[model samples]
Target: MEFRATGADEPANDGRYAWAGTKEGHLFEVDTVELCIVSSRLNVHLSPVVGIYRVGRSMVTLEESGKVLIWGTFDSPDAPQLAGTFKSQRVPDKQNFYAIVGNELWTSSGPVTKPGSSAVSMRSPQIRVYDPTTTGSFSVLPRPMTTPESVGHVGAVTASAIVPSQDHLVYLGHDNGFVSVWDRKTYACLFVQRVSPYMITSLVGVGKNLWAGFRTGLIYVYDVRSEPWTVTKAWKAHKETVLKIVVDPASLWTDETLQVASMGSDMAIHLWDGLLRDDWLDAELNLRQPDFCTFRSIRTLCISWNIDASKPQDLSGTPQNLDFLRDVMLSTESPDIISFGFQEMIDLEDKKLTAKSMLLGKKKGDSKFSDGISSSYRLWHDKLVQAVRLVMPPECPYTVVHVGDMIGLFSCIFVKSSESATLRDVAKITVKTGMGGRHGNKGAILARFVIDDTSLCFINCHLAAGQSHRRQRDHDLVDILEDKSAFSGLGSSSPGAYAPGGDGTTVFDHELCILSGDLNYRIDARRDNVIAASMDGTFETLLPYDQLLKGLATNQTFRLRSFKEPVITFAPTYKYDPGTDSYDSSAKKRIPAWCDRILYRPSDELANSLIPPSGADREDKITPLPQQYRRWEVNVSDHRPISSSFDMQVKSIGAAKRALVWEEIESAWFGVESAMIAEARDYYGGG
Candidate 1:
């Protein structure tokens, strides 16, 4: 059926914004730039609107429900009228109505039936012909007698194309692989061809041949003139069902050029040029597969001949001249021509993963305590407490490694490097409570890294002691463990009991993860007591923490000699006062808690792997004492750097498989990255 034009200015083009009508009879406008829904309204038909096209200032909508509505005014809005309507036994799958050579408006409808539902029976495939200039009615075209009776062959006609030479039409797709052609005027079946048993999903006319894409991942080129429509070329072009195909004639002869682009359920876009004899021979010999070049799905493919004076011969033998073809193909870059539907799915998955990592910091302004005293107060007194916490940026890449009072400034450092041993300061937020106090509010940052595909590394950092402030510290730690806003649900709480300071399920079934940080509470405290006292539990206090950190020798990357005492590498960082010279005097030296530590949770495979014989011995648990303390060093905020090594193993097979799937996912939604980002902004209530 044809729609009468409703007087409406062609949809307002705010650059990338465009309107579309679906087969389900829905009118929607998408922000071409943002890929967001600008507006959507359900029109007349209950089923999806299958095809939409614009002529002059008006839009023509065709619905699968056999109802067509014309709302845009061809001449004026007030003059809008019902253009035409057609009823059919089956819903139309593909529809195209074009003005033929004469004033006659010829319309073609192929087999497109609604999905089977419990309440409705399946519809048979049929084609409808219409003369818009006549009474504006349609009738089912006579079916070819040779058409198969099986549902596979007579179900939905997947595709239809009008031959450029005449009003003749090619209807070559099926729920089965049967392809048939007919003369529109005579209703004569010229040929019937079956290229494969697999269902034909798409059809494209290139030159004198017809290309058919199959659900079985194969493509066949048919010579329509030959009896029974001989198949000229056939190749396996995809790993999954082929969804759509577009032929680019201009790229037919270029070196390793792409003559056709196909998208499939696998989320990959495959590019193909006509196969060379050698390539086909290799495939036949099982020596090589067809040269199926794959691109990220976001890329749309189209053909353009080199029209510039420098390469005029590129247009030879094509139907259109170089300039005209170039104008047609290059008017919209290949990237813009193709569209996809699964971007939302991929984006949803990405958002889900990002949320998993958001719980790495304490909620705003929560107090943290260590030992039985307030670590916040002690750090504030020492001028080491900075702001107690800082909100992480939405897209911050570094995983928070540690956060605590460095002296009195709230200091936090994130593990900036994903490769090896490297920690960098991501942010050092400073908070001023009053004239005398400047505290650093470094939010705890935690990250789970994929170590060579199969393994992950979890790094944690802890800050020095404080009694009553331990509760806040515990809360911060818990926040880090449970936040899902960052990595989108990829992170979880410590796997175990939910008691404060006790370890819960941190990593489950994941290859390997290392949960390390400055767990302030001693490793021997009871979980319930720690929770009641509001004290941050130590490494030995929580069952999982104790099991993971106990017996793991500390890797001290720095050392200090306090009060000129015999070179000492280990000293409690909190007890030293800058004014007392206790750090410089030789008479009395105070030993303090081993506040800085690093732990490694190596899997069995990694634990058994031998350390490289040439590198620094992995046995160095204590860092050598620095020869002298710089100005910042004397107070330099207390904690020393700690480092460790892991014999992380690579799982090549798993990694390769993951890479393949990832490539497909990326390809399937290639151009829609910005759309996905926009969706995220919307989901997060951002503009």
Candidate 2:
């Protein structure tokens, strides 16, 4: 029969048996080896058990009503005899939670616990200490220590733990995306750092590392032993919000690798290598040696524009540029892959229409809203496909790989029909960054796929507007990179799971990541001077005033700084008058800036192309070379369209060869580990 387990715990001294509590107030004594219930008792508590803990030799079950029941010793399992019961005295948490730190029970508490102190705001939350050893008696510690009010809000505590390797330290995860460390003895807040914009769901202290699971299904491991801790590793571990994380005790005994298990809201549990040791890195290098790989060179064309809500038919104009799409397509000759990205495809000033359309768009599975909000995307998609058919030869057909739209932003990718079969794990996802991610008026749409064995990703973004919102645009880019929601219909195992040829989710997981859009960064200069500079053809002189360029050159932002952009050879692509060569004359008179642009971050294989390989073919490594970067004067919108072309290398015949290499590496690593473990056990005098 199927059973839903609510709370479970294994004894610290025994590994053969485990205790579990169910939502129906039933308790089960399960055998770890047989995976069957050895004994069970109904009506163990009146309320549903929310947590189960191991205290000394007794097993305690916490109920939803704040009552905890302690059972007698399990040396002789005769249906667990109830030893005692007590109603926990503490402030109730949202999850009705309690944590076991040694023999004491810990719960959350509000601010202002001490008398005669300034009535602090609830922004400063704390953890209450209680002793549950003496049943039927209230034993509490002194005033609970408050967390640091370093920010406007610390948020409620979601999870807490005391480091197993360092018993003097305590770590807590908060809903405000901050993690705080405290001294267990003095209860003094030691360090506070904001790790993510998403809420931290669970925290676990193992060895010298602390693992934090986020609501976005990502995991971050921190090294806490040193002063001012640092993130050791971070990756997507699940498809939904993680509920809890636990480490296998047996794995911890090795003092090297850690085996972590996490449960998420997606109704699934995931196992991960929580901490990567030196041995793991050595194994990884052996598997990805690149000796048996083969590469194919392909040309890619990417075009981006802020269309300003113009329809495709309106793209027709003077004889010199009668059909804008065809001219743009033929500008780059015989590209193997072509991508079109458009921002502000719909009228953003219509707030009511935008809000309603965003709400309805979520329900229709990539369809337009009832009010025709996505009609512009459909028109552009058809127009671009028709343009491709007209420009390319009939023998060399093109196929639409994927099309993704996020309200005012749209992105579509196409490839030569002959290369369509080489695509695998193709996925498209949209991230909303407008109004605190509640609306899609400003956001990003991303498409990722594996071309043969090489992974590539394309991101089309429309960041926050205004000349003074540079920081907001940087934050928007970070949010897009951190999003790890597994693409729908790819199954739970698809994300973050090991597969051949670097298969995974997230933007950075790909070998080549291209970002193109109306990034909205402005030139730090007066409007008249910017317009004069653009008109005088002295655009190269204005590079120092470009916010995006400054950020990239100085490496101001974390992820965006890594990308490289082609040298600007054309004038600014923004703030032009419709159907005219003049700059903006409206009241806003927006300064001319290179807002529409493309940037790319290539993998290390391309970065190390200068060095000769040991034994692998030098041609096997992919090196992306930018050929052209220019802008077109199609003035249907206030912003001119920008395009970039690149000659990118892709893997063609390498999956089978890489898989064979991986098998040999795996076997060698297993043998090495076994011999080392045996030798160490003999030296240390242990089994």
Candidate 3:
């Protein structure tokens, strides 16, 4: 605990720079001088305000969900106007979205380095500036590779701040310690500079001089005006990771009264008069400590299902549109995340379905009717979105953050506006396990995303139909579970979920994996007896009769070692007559069995990792399985939609705690790298 607080607030790029964040999802504007929120608004936005900048006429706020709103700052407590909003690249943005109304600098980081991924390569598209008004954006590429071996992997753009130079240039920082000064007008690389050997954490600029904070507490002063940026001064400033550095943009370097403040993980904020100071530069051995507060860990979890609508023509009937959004919306609070998976969204006869085979055979090339299948998919997706919005309350605004389809299997994910701030590292992968080897009548899609630093995966799979073809169904399961693309990480052009395995590959790699779709497992019992038991509420007695459950348990072929499923409390969900509540009374009197269902399996380490030993025991804090995991009453399609809900624990360790943890990791990383450098020097010097 430091007497002076280590605030995580970031300084604005504007001349009258201010900091804005949220207290309970409402807006808070901090005065740089007072170092406290000056204007706290009354109008509450459920979406936590992750970013805010004061530009020309209004203050622009970027919510966690990537929603950008331009608000009028004239009246301190006035309602901000909603400005143009667009989706930025998905990454674990530690509130890393930096915007200059002149030109916004934000990062869309590469995929999370899975546990066993190879060392990350440098030099890729990581940073960019976009105009909220325009549809296009300019990419800011990093400096050229300087050596065969470099400290940074041209990886994530760790930190960036708008340089208050004459042109209002953007000073971009990378994990690799390289810096680039770029022209906002042409986005041309103006010059490159490497000021530190350690990782660059944050940057601030005043006139011609740039101040950079590193993972080590060292701060570097770079003269940006020099052809090759030159470091004028370097100082060990803090006892921990330097979280942020802010200089008054209006102050000139020559001004003796130039104000600069540095905050660090040390829990102490230091106010330095100017860049050059020999006074107390070393980390203080004994500092006054600030009292720490108890932190709470709890958040929302939701599950939804998409029942078949028969086809596009019948979407509006049965009044066929009973959607699953209502089950997902939390009554006491908003679900931090929601998942909706569709069992079937396309037809076997559709031309797009056969296009893959045709292209490979050279019989017909890709269709020029770019509008054909995609346009239809869009139309269907829009319907789903519109239906979801109808059930949402005005207070809790949510949006479709991700949408993907693998042939007939479709899934969409929605995030509440407030929870979008921490949303990042989203990637999608698809694999076909249907017929003709590569072509499909069945396949699956795995959408992986990171929310609140927790990895979650949703798999929507459709297996081969027909009761006798269980072998093919099992093969499809193996294909989906053992997908080779998952190990490719973000390197492959086609990244998808792999089967559950060690070292975090595929869906098994995520902290939580939610699976839903038509598994097509039938009851091995006589059809008549199965139908009778279903009617008599004797599902328990018929449990053993389920071929899918029994077969999966015994068949090592497709059975993942540690996956789990909820107890089937609902009636059989397959082979029903369209537009009727009755089961298939026709020729294929499908033995009533739970086919369309939802289940979840946690990564082996998730439970142990999330539950701290001092906190509630895993069993006590565990959100109990949802009672509403029953089937939806909608009867538009042959298969009933099953929706289940769960509460995922969100460990919202505040920024202060994160800074402390980062300090440990950074210190360890820096120490190891420094040791490696020394080892290399020794080896080379001896030779």
Candidate 4:
């Protein structure tokens, strides 16, 4: 059933002055480049603004009461003045999108209104187009369908997009699985087509075809090149209502891929390869045949830094998070790749709980609060640049790439600048299984790439907070690992194969997986004893009580029995007061815990005799584990970020490794064979 429609937005325009109107009657103009609000103003219209549009040198804002307010957007010394006010006598639908044509604002404000008649219903077959300069309005009705018996009423128009090739044409999607092409010049419905019975929440026009996303999480491609538009294809795109569908700008000229990206209410964004749908479908069905980009091996040094989106400095006036990250990047030895996972990269401002969180901000100007980059991500980017330029060896300078976030949780990867020439097929995947339902307060981000010839993956996740949410926390962890299976995201399925499970559910699926973030696993120890343990350096005694470590051992989550985690030696990394080593003494008195962590899972075996590094071998100093693992006592956020530096072993991709990866893929379905033992020795030395 369709939801009861509320306020509607006037059709949006993509011109020089991008306009956004809030519910409080405040209008803001934002620059596309700087990605921040450049200027803002309030209007006399007290109703919530549902739509904004840019028409020539003027801006139009649509109010809830079907009122249109136009203001001059001139760059003169004088402030913007109200240009005109008009009413189409039409209300907007929150789920419907409108477009523009020939200086007119087209809106799906509810049912078509007849001249002098005021019956308004979502089931009406007509749409209203309003002229920007005048209150003049006209109706565009859908052509009749099923002979003369029934008019082509397409439920409520939920989504719409401009057809680039034909400016006079627009695509309209309805809640009852109806799609139609409406002609602005002739006021005729070119054709009406019905798909699955689901609401079309979003639509995007790509080339001559139109893409539509439905509330059922399905996607349909309409080939509108010929006289009769045909539904070319469909795919299951998401698990929840598809909120928006956007074409990859790069898809314009590239014949290699007709890629489109989408975000749904399920708290996840999906990247689809439109051209390679068959290959994707096949892999989705047969997970073993996932053609992961095979590489010999890749080594990565991973550090998880919680830059305390709220106050990132310490009492000593040091940007401790930045210092910790920079220092590690400089001192960490030759890792082909480096990744940093960050949590709370922006201060969550719930003013009722406000405590004046400080941030590393830009000068008061265009970049101020620019996409929150000033206070949060930019710090990580700037620190990496400084570390590479000032500290890293001249020959091995690194170039940083931001694996951005859906919420504030983010992850980034740094690779040798020199390797850019040889590195190929880089992919990044970000999934937000938000703990706060669909709001994205918690989730995971991943960056995958092949450096030289080795494939590596870096993962960062923020799970559900608090001790009582243990089950929810573990579920989020398992969700990320499972959702990322079988090259389901980014560039292509890696060319390599994971030896242990042959399944893609875990990062163990990668050659070298370094997963980190604030896991929020609190200890049950008494606060006094926990504080004393930290002060007396007997914190290791609390290791047995750590929830995350214990959870992994008992449950089937991660199922990574072979993955290795370095022993932690630092004090509890949580609930610290900003700028000091003291624990939280606030009213809530949050318990201290090692919430921030870094763990690595190495690939099982590259060759027959490789005998992947494990347990007992570490005592001999030849182990594959990190050389150091400890917490950084930088009292920046309530949680002290931890760092791990290690030199991992990676074999170069060659004939031997290639054969083994393919062999493992086949073995996944066929099961182990006696010949595998003999074949292992031939490819990998039989250790």
Clash counts for the predictions, in order: 97, 0, 16, 18
Estimate every model's Cα lDDT from 0 to 1. 0.36, 0.70, 0.54, 0.57
Q: Which regions in candidate 1 have their CA more than 4 angstroms from the true location?
A: 1-18, 21-25, 34-39, 53-58, 71-125, 131-156, 163-167, 248-259, 274-687
Best by lDDT: 2
Summarize candidate 4's per-residue lDDT along 1-687 as a digit string, tens digits.
001111123112223335667788776666665678676667655677876654544456677766666564322222333333333334444424455443567666444445666644334444666666543443323332111114446677777776444556877777766767777676566666664344678888755567888776666666666543444444456777899887554443334345679999999999875443443233332233224333233345677866667533332456654466556665556766777777877655553211222232224764333453445556655655666577667777777754566456767677777666665546566666663434455777776655543446677888888877877776576456543223443323434332222223334345556678888888887888888898899998888888877865653223233355777868888888876778988887887888888776643331101112223322211123445676765666777767776565443335454466556655553333233233323322212
What's the true lDDT of residue 111 in model 3?
24
Better of 2 and 4 by lDDT: 2
How many clashes in candidate 4? 18
Q: After superposing candidate 3, which stretches have Cα over 4 Å from the reference?
A: 1-333, 349-372, 485-505, 551-558, 606-624, 652-687
TM-scores of the models, in the given order?
0.30, 0.69, 0.46, 0.48
**Whose TM-score is higher: candidate 2's or candidate 3's?**
2
lDDT of 1: 0.36
Candidate RMSDs in order: 27.9, 7.8, 24.3, 20.0
Among all windows of ten consecutive residues in candidate 2, which has the lowest summed lDDT?
605-614
lDDT of 4 at 291: 40
Please give, for residues 200-308, the per-residue lDDT of candidate 1 as tens digits: 7887765456777877665666656544344454445666778888754334323323256888888989876433332223222211111121111111111111011
Q: Which RMSD does model 2 reach against the true structure?
A: 7.8
